[model samples]
Target: MTRARTLPAASHLEARLGLEMGQYSCAGRKAINEDAIGIRAPDGPLLTTKGVAAVIADGVSSAEAGREASQSCVTGFLSDYFSTPETWTVRHSVQQILTALNRWLYRSGQGLPDARRGFITTMSALVLKSQQAHLFHIGDSRIYLLRDGRLEQLTRDHTVPVGDGHRYLARALGLDIHLEADYRNLALERGDLFLLTTDGVHDVLGAAQLAELLVNAGDDLAATCRTLCDTALRAGSDDNLSCQLLRVSSLPTPEIDDVVGRLTQLRFPPPLAAGNVLDGFRIERELHASPRSQVYLVRDVQSGERFCMKTPSDNFSDDPAYIERFVLESWIGSRINSPYVARVVDPGRPRTCLYYLSEYVDGMTLAQWMREHPRPAVEEALYLVCQIARGLRALHRRETLHQDLKPDNILIDASGQVKIIDFGSCSVASIAEIATPLVRDSALGTASYAAPEYTVGRKPDPRADLFSLAVITYELLTGTAPFEGKLERCRSQRDFLATRYTPSYRINPRVPHWMDGALRKALRFHPERRHGDVSEFAHELQHPNPAYLEYHQRPLMDRKPLLAWQLIAAALAVAELVTLALLVG
Candidate 1:
C-alpha cells in the first residue's frame, strides 16, 4: 500500500505539506538485483523542514560490485539528508552528501583492477520542499513529472550512444574524481505525480505507459509502482527493474506568507515616550529613529531589566514586503547566540504589536567609538574586529549573511566587549528556499561597507560579509576609507576595479607594512580575491600572510601608483639639476 504522510502545522490556518510515496524493485530475469530504491519523510517539523525525499539507483552491470554500489548510495543519501543542518537549502544539503558519498566510493575502490568495476551507479533523487520539488541526478536513472495528466521528463540521461540500440553512461558517481550532479527545481502543485525509474523499467515501458499507470494508480501508489515493475518485466526486460513514485497531495503555505496575512490585524505601536508601558515593556527613552524604523530602550516591567526594542515605522505598516523583512530580522537574531552578538531576549509575554527586544549594551556604537579614538592602534583595532568576526561566524554557520556590517551596526561596550548588531539586511539561505510572492529586498548594505558584488547585481556569499568587516577594520586603523570613500560612487564592476586603494600605512603611522597587506587583500573589490570567510580574515589580521606580503612587494607602481609617480618626478628633478650644473661648468 502507498504511505501518505502529512506534516502537521502548528497554526491551524497554515496548509500542511503532504506526500504519498511508493516503491518496488525486482531482479526480473537477472540472477542478481542491482537496482536500489528509497523514500523517506520524517514526521513533525522535519517533514516540512527537510521535506520528503526519494532516490533511485541503478548500478552498472559491468561493475563487479554493482549491487553494493546501488545499495550503499540509496541508503547513505536518505540517512545523510536529514542529518544536515536545517538552515541549509535542499540543493546545498544534497550536494554535500552526494560529494561525500562520491568521495567514499572512489576511495573504497582503490587498488581494485578497475575502480568503476567496484563502484559505479546511475542515481536520481528528488526532494519536495515547501512549494517546490528539487531534483538531483547523475547517469541514466530518470525522474518524470506527471502534472494535470501530461507527462514530462525532468532529467536528461548522462549517456552517449554509439551504433545499434546501445547507450553507455558517460557520467556517474565514482567514475571521476570530481562529481557534478545536475540540479534543478520546479514549483509544485497539489495532485502532481512524480515518477522515479531505473533503465530496466523505463527502457521497457515508455512515458506513455508510465503516465497511464499513474493516471489509473489512484491513491494506491504502492500497487501502482509494483505494477510498473511487473509490466516492465513482462515486456522482456532482462535486467533488474525498480520504480518509485511520489504524489504531492498538499503544498506548504509558507509561514511568512501566512504571517503576512495576519500582520494586517496587528497594530504598529504609536510613537513611544519615556515611562510609557506597552506589552509589559516600559519605554525608557528613544535610542534612535529613522523613516523606516525606531529603536528605544525599554524596561521589562516584570524583570526590571533594560533592553533595546526595535519597532517598525508607521510608513511601512501597510507594506507586506516591509513587514516580511521586519519579521525576518527578529527571526534571524533570535536564532544566533554568541557573546559577541547582541542576544535577542524573548519577552515570554503575548504581543499585540510589531516589535522585538535585544539585550541592552551600555556602550556607544563603533562609529562613535572610532570618532573618540581617532586612529586606533592596529593591535586594538584587530582585537575588536576579531570579536566581531566571531559574531559573523555564528550567523554564517546558520547560513545567514550579515549584509550590513558598518561601524554604526557594531557596538563596543564599556567592558571592551564588541557586539555585532542589526540584521535588517541579512540574507538567509534556507529561508530563500521557500517560495514567496513578495519581493525581497536586495542584501545591500552601507555602500562603503557593502561588497562590490551587490553594486554589480551579483549574488553574495560569506565573502560579502568579510568585505564589509574588512571595511570596518580598515577605517578603524586608518581613520579613512580604503578607496577614499569612493565605493558608494561605483555603479558597475569596472568603476569599482578602477578605484585605487589608499594604503593604511600612508594614512596612519602606527600601521605596519605587513598588516596593511592583510587589509588590502580583504578589501579587494572582487569577492573572490578576498579571504574565504570571517575566520580566515580574522586569522590573517593578527598573523602575517606571506602571500600578500610578497604580492605587495612588487614594483611601487603596482602597489601604490601615487607614491611611485612622486618618486619618478623627484628623480627627474634631480637629473635636471645635475645637467644644469654640468652645462655651467
Candidate 2:
C-alpha cells in the first residue's frame, strides 16, 4: 500500500544517477554450475522508460539442461523488458515479459527425457525505476535491501522442507505450465543498497555474516561481492557461489539548468515565409502563429508528403523551462498511438532546428465545427464525446494527463472523425518524476474549461479531464458554459462548493433527464464525487443509470427556481389581501 513517493524538483534532486553493480558466479566444488546473472543499465531514453534491470537465476543441479535454462531466462528477460512499449507501466511490462519467458521455458523443455526436472531454475529479477524498486521472484532465489545500515530480505524463498532437513523448490520457472511469480514495488532512496543471491551463497553465509561483509565491504561493490563470495566458499559453500550487488547513488532530477544546458546547443531556426525551405522541409504556409509558437504546413521534399511543423517562437529563446516543455511535447506525442489522437511523424531526416512534425489533420478545429453546426442531436454530441473519451483514455493509460482539454484543442476531420490533438500543456508521468525548478501548475488549460481542482491548486488527473469534457458536453447541449463560467474562476474549495450548479436541461428541453443527470455527475466540483473514470461516465451517458435517479428528487427550488419563487410571491399576495379584507370589515 505504501507506493513510491515522487520528490519535488530541487537542486538536491539534480544529483547524478549512478547505480554501482557487482556480480560473481562460480561452480565452487561442482564441476558444472547452473547459475547465471544479467544486468542492463541503459543511458538513453530507454533508461527513463525501462529503468535498470538486474536478474539472477539458479538452475536445479539435478536437471540435465539446468545450465541452459538459467542462461535462457536471464538473457530473455533482459532483452525483452527493454524492448517492450515505453507506454507500458513497470508492473504490466515486466509481468508480460516474464510470463512469456515462463511459457517459452515450459514448452521448449518438453522434448527432454524427464519433462518434470527439465529446464528448471529459480529466478529473481529487480528493476530500479524512477524512485522505486520493482521485484519479481520465483523459487529459492533471494533479494535483500540494505537501507540505513539495516539489511532486510525482500523476497520469500519458494521452497518446501522435506524430512531430515531437506528442502525442494515448490515454485520455479518451467516447473509447471502455469507461472506464479511474486511481484512487489518499494520506494527507493538514495544510497540504498540491494543484494541478490542464490541458495548456494545464502545457505552457507548467514544473514548476520552477510550483513557484516556488506558493511565492511563499504563503497566498493565489486570488492563487497568478491569478499562475500570468498567468505561463502570458505564457509564450505561447496554447491555453488553466486551473488549480485547494486547501490543507488542518486536519483534523476529535473533541474532547470540541466534543460538550459541541453537546449542552448540547438539554436532556433530563422524566420521563414512560403516557398522557403529548411532541412528538406519546404514551408508551404504558416498554419497558426501565436505568441508562444508558429505552426507551419510543410512539405517533405524527399517523400513529397505533407505534415505540420511546429516551432517555438524566438520570443522565449532564452527561456529554459519553455524549451524543455516544448521538447517534452514531442516526446509525449511520439509515445502515444491512437486514431482518436493526433500522431507525431518522424521526418526521416535530421532536423537543423528546434521543431517537431505532426500528421496533417485535414479538418477544422472542434470550435469551428461547433460554429458550423450550432445545435447537434443528443446522439451526435455523445458520439463525439465518446471519441474524445477514447482519446483521453489512450493518454491516461500511458500515465500522461492532457492537463489542457478544450474544444480548440480537438480536431474534426472532413470525414466527421474526431481527433484530440496537442501536447503543449500535457504532463508525462516519467518526465514529472524528475524534479523541476520551475513552478508547475496543476492545470494549464483555458480557465473557461479547466476543472475546479485546477483553480484550487490540486493536481490534475484523468477525472479532471473528464470535468473538461463534461463542460464541453454541457456547452454543446445548452449553448452556454456551466455555472456562467464560475467553475474556473473558483479560487478555493469553498468557492466551488458555494457555486450553484445549473443543470443543462433547464436551458435545453431537448436533453433527456437521465442524460442531464450524467452531465451533472461528471461536472461535480469535487473529483471524488465525479465518475471514477472515463468509461463510467461514458456508460452512464449512453444508458440510464438508476443510481442517478436521485437527481430528479431534488427540492422544487433546485428543480425549478422560477416556479418555486413565483409560488412564494403568490402566497404573500394572498395573505396581504386577506389582511386588507379584515381591515375593511
Leading candidate by lDDT: 1
Candidate 2, residues 112-179, lDDT tens digits: the string is: 88888688899999998767789999999999998887999999989889989999889999888899
For model 1, the superposed segments whose C-alpha errors exceed 4 Å read 3-21, 25-36, 40-51, 58-80, 101-122, 147-152, 156-180, 186-192, 211-219, 237-240, 248-259, 270-287, 296-307, 489-498, 551-574, 577-585
lDDT of 1: 0.86
Per-residue lDDT of 1-585 in model 1, one digit per residue for the tens? 478877665221235777888888989998889999898877665665587899999989998777888899999999999988766789889999999998877777775888667788889999987788999999999999999999999999999998798888898877777998999998999889999999988889988988888888878888898899899988989989888889988777656657567556668889889999999999999999989899999998988999999999999877888887887788778878799989888889888898999999999999999999987777888889999999999989878899999989999999999999988988888777765656667745888788988889888999989988888888889888879899989998899989988888888878877878778888887778888898988888788788767866788898779999999999999999999999999
Query: What TM-score goes with each of the models?
Result: 0.81, 0.80
Candidate 2: lDDT of 61? 89
Candidate 1 Cα RMSD (Å): 4.6
Best by TM-score: 1
Clashing pairs in 1: none
Q: Evaluate all candidate structures by whole-model CA lDDT and list the values in order.
A: 0.86, 0.83
